[model samples]
Target: MTDEAGSAGALTATAGGGRWPDLREVPFKPRAPWFNGDLQTIRNFLVVEGLGRGPAPPASRRMELPLNDGTGDRLLADYSQGEEGRGLIVLIHGLSGCSASAYMKASAAAFDAAGYSTLRLNLRGAGPSAGLSSDCYHSGRTEDLANALRTLQDQDDRIFQRGLCLVGYSLGGNMLLKFLAEYAGDFPVTAAATVCAPIDLAAASRWFDRRRNRIYQRRLLNWMLRDAVRLPLSSTQRDAIMAARTVYGFDEVFTAPRFGFESADDYYAKSSARRFLSGIETPSLLVEAQDDPWVPTASYDNVDWSVLPRLHRLSAEGGGHVGFHDNASRVPWHDRRILSFFEWVAG
Candidate 1:
């Protein structure tokens, strides 16, 4: 948690297979809490600031990539034009988030500023495409993601020539990590980064069930449930869904079976990236906050960094789930950290 001791040491000691340049010299100061140090107050401030007014990017071009679902639902990828650039950076959003989400927009702007082409992937049934598919996307779904990456790669063989970078937020991060692990040598990704990911889905579900996490739990669960109810399912599926009491129960009842998994445990076991961290071959960065209310540090602790030498786990003391606002100006600490890590990796 202390940046003074250097993160590189922790990364090196933990990571065994991948080689990383010594970043011990990278000076980083942990941000202090605002609003009398009350996490709730900090959370409220960030929710308003991040989702509220902010700088906007230039006009974006929207394109739909055809899928084989026979549902006529094509994947939406938004491109924010920038000065001619070499590499392409694909941004994936968290649960219930779309290409239009605030964080995704902000990241697209950042990538454009860095002279990189940006593509914001809207997961099936996320944004405008919600009505296109009766089936919803779950955290464990990786086939669409793999297909998207391949589509991008095929669209531009230049992707392999320049480089490909993936930036996934929260649930999207979990998906990205799982995708990388599943297609370690098959993909052409040069680097990837996951921000505030709930690595251990099972732990996260239990954590959200706690009294303090109730508000967040209800918000996410309601969103997911609303989506599930919209899906055209058999009477048995509807019965199972209607009988669910909590988000975990709903996921176990609906998501698990739909995804070909036995239950929540099977889904979690198959989806969690911690088990696959040792197998990641691409240069990657996993950033989590010690105080992330939704994703606890314990979930991150399950990661064995020593096996996959190319991965760096960055744990900051104060960023709230994707809300890494710093100082009175509300500048995002996570964004700067992400840029720095990517620059380091690219260089």
Candidate 2:
């Protein structure tokens, strides 16, 4: 009913999570016939993975960005060639996701069709980047995203037509916004877009572990655990990974302690993007699904929109996380929505 600052300092429309809003008012429409949030999510995932991957990007090459952290850590990023002057887009993935994730590939394909160059990044140690770092990637690893930006700027340092777009999904979205906010004016970024980002990590964590949501939570954890075992972790970190049954356990035993956090709550508070929304000045498109499994509405509701007139918020009625399906086609509608946002920001 009321969206105000809470203990979590969350700006939420509804206390628990959210209510079903009208689809007509939403930025994008769900595929015809089916509006069920669950079905929308499932079909989005199935279709994207099964049939709708779209055409693969041509002349794509995987390049490693040197972290220069003295640990010899290098993050992986894949580049797809596009027409020059159209701009370069750096794509970031969510928790337990990589550049090769179905959504990332589909979106890259769309960008390629538009003659835009794209980079699909593997944050630090997710996906094939699992063993690349001794430290694990958390929700607020803005440092990693910053490193990627600097690397890109070094390669394509030009002021003629600054058309770089920072695109992120889920946890990656949170990190992208935080990086732009904290390091404003330091990076020459033209635009940004985030889909289904968990701005408030604490609220999201609670919602994620809820009984009915266990299936999704378990799925993410399993993927994370697979990545955890491969890294060169300390005794505490390894033990934490071994004992983690869910994300909370993983954060408590590994993420918090490893990342210099006092506890999981501390990690969530400092790492959440909700606190930094007011500080963000970048032209960004923030998309959220009314029925997204974990990302809470409080994050979107609590944002100080007046301070971010350039920041467009699109709360879709049935996108289901990042699952914005075009229904008849395998390509997700989010691809175009993101590209449209980038184009508008570029102009």
Give candidate 1's TM-score: 0.85
Per-residue alpha-carbon lDDT of candidate 1 for residues 12-111, written as tens digits (9 for 90 to 100): 3445755554443442333454422235224533554455664364468886775665666668889765555457778999987888777777667666
Report RMSD for candidate 1: 4.2
* Best-performing candidate as measured by TM-score: 2
Find the candidate with the highest lDDT and give its number.
2
lDDT (10s digit) by residue, model 2, range 1-347: 01110111212232323321222222456776547566666664566566764456556988878776676677888888788667788899988889878778877887787778888989778776665675667888787777767776676666215477888898999998888788856776788889998989999999788898777777778888888787877787677688888899888987888789999999999988888887887777788888877777777887766556657677776677787874534456667666655654554
User: Candidate 1, which segments miss by more than 4 Å at Cα?
Assistant: 1-51, 69-72, 156-160, 328-331
For candidate 1, give the lDDT of residue 308: 60
Return the TM-score for each candidate structure: 0.85, 0.86
Error of 1 at 44 (Å): 8.0
Clashes of each: 4, 2
For model 1, which pairs clash? 14-306, 16-306, 18-309, 18-310
Task: Tell me how many residue pairs clash in candidate 1.
Answer: 4
In Å, residue 264's CA in model 1 sits off its true spot by: 1.4
